[model samples]
Target: MAREIDQAHLLEYTGEFSFDHKLILEFIKTAKPDYDHTDPKTWPLITSAYLNKWLIKPYSGVLMLPPFIAYERSLVDLCVADREDGNVELVREDGVKTVRSRFHHHFPFIYNHNGHKRKFEYMHADHYTSWVFGVTGKVPATRTKGKDTPSASADPFDEILELIQDAQHAHKTDGATSLRAELESAHKDLDESKKRVVAAEAQQKLLDKELTHERRRAEGLVQSKKALKQDLQKAFRGEMEQHTITQKQLERVNRELADTNKLWREATNETIAAEARSKKLEKTLKDRDKDLQVSREQAATLQEQMVKIRNELKKGMEDGGQKRQADSNASSSQKKKVKIQQ
Candidate 1:
């Protein structure tokens, strides 16, 4: 039977399921399922079934049943047949029993159920369909379900199947309407992105032009700086030449001043010698004047002596002549007396 095959697959899958004793215990506590509460070995089977039936089954689409639900139905059928032997020992090729431990490689994005790697393929299929509708601006065809309404006395399994079909039909109809609106909005966003890119390119061109203008200005400034530096060098050379000329002129003036000072000293010495000679000549002239005055006094005394001698000689001659005349008269008188006596 088909049920028997499904059960066999379930058993094999459970045996390979990595045992996580702690995770299973926590799942059992939260879910509070109708299973053995004390035994930790039975936790994986109970928790896996719970997750498949409640979390994964209801939202599954009509076209593709989720892997979790398919696995769970097999487990359920096995339990109904013989619930006692559900827990089986899982072993590796090395003959070492797989202990209760968490699956290390399990993650949110990767769905590794019963040795099959599905990824996030069917999980968000409706969301992907809606996105396609929004982009294309098209509505997908609706999937119709059975119109027969079940009576109150209908089998419980039949009623449950009918409700699941109705729910899938409603989900498809709502998704198509919402997707159309999303597609129109996505088209407008694409137009806005294109406009932004064009504006950015225009702005980039303006920036490049400004950069070129600045480079030209920088070159002009460099030329001006070089010219100014050359002018400064020329001015500095002129100032140095002027300083050399001024130093030479000052040396010439100093030599002239020394020559003038020497001439003035020589002239002063000559004037002093001439004044000494003039004083000596004036003393000689005063001595000569005193000698001439003594000569004139001696000549005047000699003239007075000569005049006195001449007056004495003239007086002596007059006395002598008078005496001679008197003598002659006496002799004549004596001779006359003798003649009278004889």
Candidate 2:
């Protein structure tokens, strides 16, 4: 349930109605120089005079003095409770405000004090976390004897009853002369009582409507908070799922990069080995060409020596045939001359 405002408690709790805490404490000490404010038992009794003296007339014509609050912290005039001007306003989460007026419980009540009927608000003091509502005034009331005002021992209710009996006796003794005036007074009092009752009933109906509206506002606030909590929970879950997927993709990419680096290292080693074998083959081909040129020069020298030996043999045979023919002709001539002479 949304709480209805307790005007007295709100007055004590809010600084708007009370004087400065330090100033109130100073006033308490000034009221009783020797009284121990720390000890509740020694604290001076509060009275209307002290409360009255504490309030200076406010610059605003509406200055309400403290005596307006009765000893019970209630409005001194209960019949005027319905006529108060207090209001309440509530602010919603969307920045809209609902205003209500004519709250009556506790008041800047009007009461008679200091020989003048003055407007008064509540007055309270604080001492080390404990509040001293000028509920106990700065001064105590002293009764002096021989006055029309009630004595210190008088019971006000008993006095009012006694005065009523005295009035009845006087009217009876005065006879027909006072009867008409007495009847008129009774009729006036009855009319005022009826007016007060009608006002009280109208105020009660207004209070009932305000209470229903406050209850609905409280229920709406609870539902809005529950819906906001659910939205935050869903958003957090989606972010966590997306974070998990990204982490898995990063791990897969790292593994693929490692495999590519391993293949690059293996290919580089094979290329180095192939280059070393090609250099060795080129050195062997150069050595083989030098050996083939030396073998061709030795074969050409042996062929030339064979051709010179054939030419020398043919010339020696021709010269020997010619010398043999000459020797045979000389022998034939000598034999023919000998035959002729015979």
What TM-score, over all chains together, does every model reach? 0.24, 0.25
User: Candidate 2: where are CA atoms >4 Å away?
Assistant: 1-185, 245-342
TM-score between model 2 and native: 0.25
- The pairs that clash in candidate 1 are 19-101, 20-101, 134-183
Tens-place lDDT per residue, model 1, 72-183, is: 3333333223111111122433453322111111210122222233332222323222322322333333233222221224223233233334434544233333333443
Clashes of each: 3, 8
The local distance difference test score of each candidate is 0.35, 0.36
